[model samples]
Target: MVNKAWRIIPRPLLETVLNNHAQHHRVPQPLILHGPRGVGKTTLILERLLGEWNKGPHLTGYIDFAESIEDHHPQFNKSFPWASWSNCPPPALSSCRSKLEHTLESMVEKGVKLGTISSHQIFTTLNKWHGLNTALRRVIQSNNAASKSAVVGKASPSVLWDRAVFALSARCNAQEIDGVLGLSEKWKGLSIEEASYFREAFLALRLAKEVITVQHGWRANAIAHLNRTGGFSRSLAHSCTDWPCLLLELLSQAAEIDHFQPKLVINNIDVLRNATLNDDSSVSASMYHDSLIWRMIALGANERCLPIILVTSDSYYSYQAYLDFGFTDIFISREMFGWTPQEAKMHMVTDYFSPSEWTVIAEVLGPIPRHLFELYALKQSDYYQKVMGDKGSTFEDIVDAYLAYLQITVVNPAMDNALELLKKFAVDARNGKISKDKLRFGAPWRHPPKTDDPTQCMEWAKLQLMDFVQCLVNTEFGDWEETLHSFFALFILLRLAVVGMIS
Candidate 1:
């Protein structure tokens, strides 16, 4: 059986550069690997690069934000990988976001645990930040009415102290208590502003302590405690800074313990932008900036000298993000390129494709690894069987069939009348109904056609095709204006290939 997806041809030169930047001696600047869709950026990092790096003592973490933001574009056929992978009716953005956040926290915690050499150090840090002593001192230092008379340097432990002690001691008892009653009471004494600040900081510390010490059901217990006490709030959702701070702190400590700066690979980070669009839920754009997740990670990488690689297929979205986050200067970008024809043939599976077959494949698909894979997959599909239907399974036959499949499944679903309009335009040019200048220059796509019957309008077809290319096609194709003619030429070639005119 032919594999639908194949391993990316290793780029020794690119890998060397990546390895140089990913050195453990010092933290490298954040790397943004930008490229067109399906150029093997994800596969390169996840499979080849990470696999090589994992052989060493270094630790690495990865997360894909795209997993949360599904493509809702309608796909008529599931024969091709791209169409099959795109979700029709995507899952709710809110649910997806919640899941992503949880996954991020979980990844952070797991990384911390894996790298932690001393739980005792973690316990001591937790005590210093949010233990009973810290809580009592916080109350004494408060400017609230309840603590007006309390001296910061020398203060007696109030009833709050005794209750907190009991809560701590109860951990050893048959029935364990959270030891937060006194802390929660004192937490309410401060002003609303102070309370919100105090709660996030305190809870973040508490969660870290629980994660390091308890190890199991810590997240559930923490959430249950918050819910039971009505402590969960909207501020904690997006605007929360404490958790992000804690995550960085924990990562730093883990790096210190492991004696090597761990690498962080975050893929499809532009999904932060995607999540905001068309979302009816409470998820907002401000969350990306206000929450310390992205910006904070960048800051942490620079400060701690941790190697952080942020991958995005969408350069425009990332550029906007870089500006909004005020870290345009921090990221060092590397543009991932597709294979060259000479290079592609060197790595091509000669056993599957003879020399002649590969020449035709290369000529049609250019040097794109993804297109080649999709074509290979299409040949083995039921769609291929339907297209071939007792015809010889030649390379040209499969290429023609793939083009037809793309038109019927991907293109037609998006723009129903595009192909028919092209056919009519071709006929119009042949019969002298269309002028020589019009045929040479092609249809003007200045404005969308204003007509009830869009299928009959060539301008509408051109505009619709441009729109589809902009959204569904790879961003590396340059401007839609420039690619418009090349795109139409593909359809024209498809028509010729189907009728055996191309040969």
Candidate 2:
């Protein structure tokens, strides 16, 4: 049997180092694996952990939102998580938002119904990550006036608060929740008192979300409808403020009910930052709720819930960002997942590259894993053929012969306009060849956003895009036919979108 298509490089030491640190209940610390792009940040740091995290007692869930944008790029909000997760719901936004918040509060109050959001939605599936004593400590602190004042808020007579504590009691021990409040005759309750600090900061962060806004009834008299029949809806409509963040919070605490241990691996913590792009306040408010949920989990992760591993590339690592956003100090520097020059050398050696060739390429590319990988992908004449493949070119010639051949000869853009600076700089920022081509192609981008000759620009764009597709499908460079098929389908889709827009 032969298996060649699917594989990954083994980096067991890095994985072991991360697991050992995160799983340590005695002294857990978050690790940071930050490095420049092309240094194997994605492959080694992210992919390696993803490949082997399941072998342990914990289950991992990843959410990646990077490597989709590049260099000073401006992104449209039409993308998936970017769009749906960040955009506000239509029309009666206020009513929908109120209902959403009320729904969550109700879930916290009366136990979330089994078939509803608490038990059936994403949060339910994620309930295996138990938060033993995390919620209970909050209830304990909320109960004692001295502790409550010292920690978060004044002792307020709120029914929702009591209900929240009762709900917490179901997950944690019904009796132990009471016992933690009292210390044994021999031992002092110093640890419990100190631990209230964790609960306080988390609760303080969440206090805004729990604001009690009581609306007056429309009854003429007290007896109009004395008894309130039932409670809020269990499952909520998709229309709500901070829906994604709330969903994340609910998922994070889902396992808290029964004290099940599950690891949640949310990738690309950086992408959430984009929510602020549209309306900073709304996004910030939602993130506060998310932070509160993580804060609770983080405060008690060592002695309680399973490790919630958050992944991101070095470009947007959340280590400093977490602190900058006023999050509780829960993460420790887990590990720096980057290859050394020796490791890069080993990668080249493993790929069957000769020392003499790799040495020269390595010196030129400067030990970047991605750069090395791209160079190794093409065989002999791969280096020079790309450099001066078809010209009176010298090694000293300053030109991207590799990209030029790969573009025109291998993977060309529109036939004639391939060299046109406008289309070249369309998707990317003005850099290197793009800047030079601008002088040659004559800054067409300088035209108004709605150009005077829209049809010409449109035609040129269509031709360039199709030419790009042709190169992609060309087997000479790589077998990208299936990918090209998908691209063509997307082209048809874009056409339909354009038609719809016109209509």
Best by TM-score: 1
For model 2, the stretches where C-alpha displacement exceeds 4 angstroms are 1-7, 21-32, 45-47, 55-57, 67-260, 276-281, 284-305, 314-319, 322-330, 335-337, 380-503
What are the clash counts of all predictions, listed in order?
1, 10
- The TM-score values for the models, in the order shown, are 0.58, 0.40
> Ten residues in a row with the worst lDDT in model 2?
211-220
TM-score of 2: 0.40
| Residue 101, candidate 2: alpha-carbon lDDT | 47
Q: Tell me the alpha-carbon RMSD of every candidate.
A: 12.8, 17.1
Cα error, residue 199 of model 2, in Å, equals 32
Error of 2 at 395 (Å): 9.9
Q: What's the C-alpha lDDT at position 331 in model 1?
A: 63
Candidate 1 C-alpha lDDT tens digits along 1-503? 33334555688887877888776534535677876555677778977888765554566667665564334321332222232122233334454445545544554444433324233344444444343444543432332434434434553433444333333333332211113223344545556664433333333434343333332222334434444564544343332333444454455555642354566677765555445424323324335333544545445565654566777665443355567556676567687877877888887756445678788987766767677777776766887667667666656888887778766765554343335556466556556666655444444652233343544465545654555455434544444355455444434323222211111
Question: Model 1: number of clashes?
Answer: 1
Alpha carbon lDDT of each predicted model: 0.51, 0.38
lDDT of 2 at 212: 15
